[model samples]
Target chain A: MRYAMVIDTLKCVGCSDCVVACQTENDVPHGYCRDWVTESVIGTYPEVEIELRSERCNHCDNTPCVRTCPTAASHVIEGGIVLVDRDLCIGCGACIESCPYDARYRHPEWGTVDKCTFCVHRVHKGQDPACVSVCPTNCMYFGDIDDANSEVSKLIAVRKYKTLAPEAGTKPQIYYLI
Target chain B: MIPFQISGSEEVFISGRNIPHIDPHLTLWEFPISLYLFLGGLSAGILFFSAVVHLINKEDEFKGAAKWAPIVVPFALSIGLLALVYDLGNPFYSWRLYTTIRLESPMSWGAWVLLIVTPLSILWVMTYIRELFPVIKYENYKMPFLYKVEELAVKYKKYMALALLPLTIILGIYTGILLSAFNARPLWNNAILGPLFLVSGLSTAAATIILFAKSHHERQWFSKIDILLIVIEIGLIIHLIMGYYAGNEMQIEALDVLMNGEFTTMFFGLLVVLGLLVPLILEVFELAGFKVPVIIPAILILIGGLIFRILMVEAGQLSRILY
Candidate 1:
């Protein structure tokens, strides 16, 4: 089963409720983040188009980070959830350089590469990911993308969507519906 | 838990897994990685030249390089290893780098090469110590272990040189591969980097030998070799620039930094003109039987070689796709 997160950009108001919830649930240290919102202003002021994108690790099938890591500390699990084994990480920062999305960060306290795990621990208990549950608009969907009956797969089948850096050939699991 | 203010300029202090989505112009893998690349290339390049000289030149009339290559390569490699170790800073988890070998990882390939080459190069130098300095033989007494090591080195020099050739090539080219494997960095993803760094390594090693040559004939031979490698390096560099200019949008963005951005001075003035081109011209003149002193070009090439490595490392980090 390939788990994925599908985000509906049109429904998001950028209130950052999910961002706050993620922090509280993960107990992440300050001055670092596993997910972030990027703001972009396209076109001139009169005809301006503003976009807010929330991004985290894509959990790619062909990750440059996984390929370049000296140790196998960065690995993909059964559902294609990329996780860092902090016990094995040497904090060499090679994976930081290899990530095109700039998704991962060094944990301020532990000095190990850290990123979103899609709340895997909570998922095993049959709970929604922290960010998805906290999103007030209910714009984010998380489920097995491979399961045609899943909400995430259904949302992706009909929505006009896009993904970042397709040229990178990483085949990200995250999808953004515009 | 500071929220994103409407306007932004400062970095945020994120509380959890989330931060504002933006790729800051962050530079990763700094001084230690650069030092490792430069020293690794030099060490491997010197050993490669040493092996070639040992095979071709039967008479050891002027064998300073043959003796120095094995001794100096390992010394340079050890410093690079130290730099890498310090960069890691987590000795506890660093051992994992050796326990698992990922074939696709350039860093894994590099680690194994270093572990093998360090001792092998030392052995290569050991075989020749008696020839370089006969004092060990002239001394009245010698330790049995020391004598045994010396005998093994002399006995196995030919086989070791043959064995060391392929490994030396890997050591020289591995630095470029290491950088290029980071597909996120546009400037470093070029295939030309492998050959470019290899030629650069060879030229730098040639310059080093020229500096240390005890006889005029040895100096002239190494100088001639340097001229060839330098010329090839110029062509490869130009190819790199042209390839970038003709590449896709993000790739061109990387070139724009080296071409016209803040790095222009260091890229054009320091690395291109002074570091590489000046040395090339000086060596050309000397090759034509001009009266230029060997040390002048040798020193310039060495300085240029080091600066070239530093600029590549910094510039590649500067050229990020996300930023």
Candidate 2:
């Protein structure tokens, strides 16, 4: 299945629910968050609008992270989720360095790098990721793009969507609706 | 926008080191550690090439086959690894690099390659260990693995040379590719980096091999190799620096960091002087029919190569663009 996520910037309140949800689920190392919020602001306070974009690993299909991996530790999983094998990782941080988005983190205990995996564990258990479940704004959506009946696929079909860093050619899984 | 604490107008953090009021958005790991990898790989590559030439080609025709090939391989490989480990933040964890495989990372690939090549190389040199030290042979019997490798090298000398050629190229190219893989760092993002590294590897490897061989005949063969390698290196450096100058604003800024910033001293002083100039001088002496021995030039060349790696890695990292 071609798993995908679409984040609606207008609906996001920048409450950081996604960050907390991600941290709890992944046991992310302190001083590092798998999912975070980016804000772009313009003009004075009276006229200003803080544009918030929730960011995480795009899980690109043509990942440079995969290309730079010497031991084949970081890879794309069966369901199109890019995963890092903690067992095989040597904590060399090459993948982390290669990642343009700053999505990856070096786990304190694992010693290897970790990043958003599109909630691969939850998918295996037939459940939604904690962040999707916890997002009160319903700004985040995830489903198989192959299943046209799925809400995510239908929404993507009907709306104009964008992915981060198109020049990178990773074919990012995360779609942003403008 | 979320507030970012900047102590200066454009201060940046590069590889955990803070550069105040510098290029605030660039982050690169062009460190001593990274440079050592490049040098070490080059050293290994040169030895591989030299050994191949010695093993496959008619040694009777070559001037310094017996003395130089045997001496250069082990010494360069051994010292190269020493420089590598010494540059690491935690050298002990280096062993753990072998316990796992991460094909996505060039350093991990390099680590594995080094592991395989180091021991194989050591064994290859041990073929002449008896000649180097006759008493050591009588002290201990040979291990089965070492004996088997010796047999393999002798039996499939041509095949080994062919096999080693590609591996050496890969080992050399991977050094530049390792840094190039990081697109976030504009200085390392150039396509020419791989070729630049390949040339640097060949030149440095030549310097290292020349440094260790002591005899006159050995010096002649090594000087010949050095001349060819150094010319290629100079050409590549010109291309790389020129490309940096001709590229976009970011590339030029990065280049400025090398030419005029913190790395200026090392780049102009150590890498240019020790790595390029002195070695070139030694080569000229050889070309002019002077009677310089192999030891001094060989030592100077090796020192120059080491300094070059240090300069490249440090100079390349002086600019910071990412916070």
Candidate 3:
């Protein structure tokens, strides 16, 4: 099953609650983050438009990180969720260079590359990812996109949305409803 | 109501990303990777020249290229491998690179190539051990086993050369492919990187031969080859820039990084002018019977080759497609 995330940009307030939730859930180092909030201000002053996005790994179907990795450290598990095997990783940082979203980071303490896993542990236990659960604006939705009945699939099918860097042809799973 | 409008005056500002490595630039790879690529290319070039000389039966006339230069390959490769290991975050798990091979991964291809080529290089050098050092007589030292292995190596030296010819080409191209495979990095996504790196490697190897060769004839022979390779390298660089300039938005921005960005002076002044052009002109004059010291151009080419790699790695990381 292809798991995916749908984020409603209009509902997001740029409060960064998802960013804090991910760090606390993953125990990420202080200076590093697995997810981040970005505020894009476009156009000149009086005619400007602002977009607030909570961004993380796209967990692409054609993941360059998995393809470029020297060892099989980076791999896509069931549900098309890209994950890193810390034990097998030589930590060469090739995957980091190949990522288009700038999603992955080298963990300072573990010395291995780390990124958002869609909170696989929580997902397996029938719960939403920390970021989705903690988002007060209820802007985020997560489910198996492969399942026609899933919320994520329904949202993507009914709404006009966009994915980052479509020209990259990575087939990113994250959808942002404009 | 009609309002006056300015064309293409919109600006975009992004905030809250401020990530150290990912935001300002990608610094995941540093000097160690550049050194490894340089030394790896140098080793490939040395092996290529030595093997070709052996295959062509010019070992007697070009003793320096065939024997002395091959002697340096193993040492250079060893140090390069050490630099690679040092660059790894989990170097202890480096053995994992060999557990399984991913054909799509250039890094996997490099690891496998090095695994085979490193030992083969040592064996190639072993064949010339006695000729390189006359003082250590293996007969008197009671190392008949060592002597026998050396004898076998010399007997099958031609076969080793045959194997090395293609492997050297692969190794040379692999250095460039490693960087170019990162499609997300706009500056490194160009296809010309492969041949550019290969020609640079050959040129650097020729310079090294010029530096090490004892005979004037051997030095001049390689000097001419280096001049040709330098010209090809310049042509490739021009094509690379032209391709980037005509590419999409990200590629155009990537070209800006080299042409007008922070790397402009280093890329143009050091790599193009001083590294490749100056050395090319000097080598040309040297061929014309001018009393130019061969070492000057040789050293300049070596330094320039190294600077080219460092700039490619650093600037390529700084130029991203998503940004």
List lDDT for all candidates, in order: 0.80, 0.66, 0.89
Which ten contiguous residues of candidate 2 chain B have the minimum total lDDT?
Answer: B12-21
Best first by lDDT, ranked: 3, 1, 2
lDDT of 1 by residue, A26-102 (tens): 98776566676665555556876766667788988888888888899899988898888998888887888899888
TM-score of 2: 0.75
lDDT of 2: 0.66
- Per-residue error for B113 in candidate 2, Å, reads 5.1
Q: What would the per-residue lDDT of candidate 2 be over residues B1-323, giving only the tens digit for each residue?
A: 11433232221112121212121222323354654655556655665655566675644444234334545555656676666665433355567667667666667787777776666566555655555666654325645565666666667655555666666677777777767767655667777777767776676665555654445565567678777777777787778789989876656777876788777777777677776777688688876898766566656656666666556555554432332
lDDT per residue for candidate 3 within B181-205, as digits (tens), equals 9989989987999999999999999
Residue pairs in collision within model 3 = none
Docking class of 1: acceptable
> Candidate 1, residue A146: CA error in Å?
0.8
lDDT of 1 by residue, B21-86 (tens): 233444656787888888888888888888877887733644757765456777788898888887
DockQ of each candidate relative to the true complex? 0.45, 0.19, 0.58
* lDDT top scorer: 3
Q: Which regions of candidate 1 are displaced past 4 Å?
A: B1-23, B59-62, B130-144
> What TM-score do all the candidates reach, one by one?
0.92, 0.75, 0.96
Better of 1 and 2 by DockQ: 1
Who wins the TM-score comparison?
Answer: 3
